[model samples]
Target: MRQSPNDLTPGGQQRRAAIIDAAAQLFNEHGYHQTSTAMIAERVGCAKATVYHYFRQKPEILFEIHDQWIEELSAHVADTSDDVPLSEFLRQVFRDILQLMETKSDHVRVFFEYYRELPDELRAVATSKRDHYERVIESRIRTGVDTGALRPQHPRIAAFALFGMCNWSYQWYRPGHELSDREIADELFEIYFAGVRAESPASP
Candidate 1:
């Protein structure tokens, strides 16, 4: 069984986080199936038994990575004010996501690539959170549509397109590239907004 946060000492909490960090790097370098608990322990400079003390199994570590990544993103989105225009909201959210990809590349990789390797029960948790995140995006799109800020279209489809543009950047985006992450996010947002923006009335 995983150690409960309520029970863990401050040091214990740090150790658990260290284990997750080490495991994320290893998982990104070597496929999850190829990476072993022993490798994670070695990377963290702890014994394998110590890793087991915090997590019951390898899949638990995978779940931790996915859970933390999604929670961070969800929290950021939640903080955004409803008063902000959808265009501005998208710009902010996309930039935040790209910035995270720049810093937490391994975590983002595990989120996108290794989720299916999780056990059925654990996979369900990831799926549920992901579904909730998508719903949040769809809700914003729906609000934009109702307010006439966005064109009349399927909110769900619009949300997926937004995710596609933002999330897929983990595959190709690099820090210190010719275009900064913010620049890339802004350019992509413009492409998305152009398709969805409501048309203005004709001039006399």
Candidate 2:
């Protein structure tokens, strides 16, 4: 029987992870436009054929990286129950995304840089996963509006704006510097909610 990917031996798994890590860093630093499979293999101390054994092409490696990122973000969002209050849930969601961005900064950077180079089919899959994440945020914003915790407005628009605010942080966020991720999330939440929530239930 053919072994599943998860059935790989420990050393095999470690080698695969190392290759992915090296590829992601190269793609991030040099961009997919400038990076090559040979560079990836060199960085990982593996034969070029070894990298090909795992990924058919450089773009395929990028697709895998993006797929893994989406899967992880989806899992995190899925674990958050709707039973939580909207405000708190939003807080959790923001913090979780920020943490993901921080942990996968290199991958995220490469994703944004090379996403356009993915084949049409792969791009569709990636776009759908991205849309799903946006929908999750929009759903929570809609819930907040329904519960009187947020102002009544277009949920999709609010979700997009909110996502943009948080996603753009990847461009400027620095680790172990001035602000912690939690502190940044808290400040952003306060600014976002204060402007969006209805005041006194009486304002025109």
Candidate 3:
């Protein structure tokens, strides 16, 4: 389990949060290797030691960034109830993921780029959470297929295809572009679930 960093005083906790926030943006903008601790400190307007005071190493920050996200996301996925109709549950799951990525696009980018940069031990922890994420989505897809709510297909392929639609949003999705996140997710989910072909025959 990742340490909460809650043992620190309120001020200390705030500083640590600020450091992670700055580091994620820098790491995402300038590749983790290109971004240095000094740049992180400069961005946060704190001394280099202060940065070190909160985190012993840059990898810890990367780990923390991933930790913060996966912990919350995992919790959300866990909370998804299987009691609902399979179709309803699936829509809820993707919308929840879209909301998360929209709210923390920078963190999403950092995780996408620097997840492998974490210490082996920390990467293992993150990897487990990712696996859990996959399992939850995969299970939902299988259930949908079994219930006739979805087309017959490989569950793992369907699961990752859904994941791809949400995960890739960090790359080009922006606020107030032509479409809202919900709008894009709605259309993407419609395509993934229903396919591109017209539902009715053409009236030629």
Clashes of each: 0, 0, 0
TM-score against native, each model: 0.93, 0.91, 0.87
**Tens-digit lDDT track of model 1 for 36-143:** 999999999999999999999999999999988888889988998888777788788788888888878899998799888889999998899989988988998888
Q: After superposition, which runs of candidate 3 have C-alpha atoms over 4 Å from their true positions?
A: 1-3, 196-204
Model 1 alpha-carbon drift over 4 Å, by segment: 201-204
Clash list (residue pairs), candidate 3: none
Candidate No. with top lDDT: 1
Candidate 3: tens digits of C-alpha lDDT, residues 5-124: 777888888888999999988988898999999999999999999998877888999988988887887787687666766656666666776776678778888898878788889899
- Give Cα distance to truth, residue 178, candidate 3, Å: 2.2
| Residues 1-204 of candidate 2: C-alpha lDDT, one tens digit per residue | 122348888887787778788989998788787888899999999899888777777777888788888888788878987777677777776787677677887887778778999998889989999899879889888877777777889999988878877888888886677878888888888788777777753311
Lowest-lDDT window of 10 residues in candidate 2? Answer: 195-204
The list of candidate 2 runs beyond 4 A from truth reads: 1-4, 200-204
Q: Using alpha carbons, what is the TM-score of model 3?
A: 0.87
lDDT of 3 at 102: 78
lDDT of each: 0.88, 0.80, 0.79
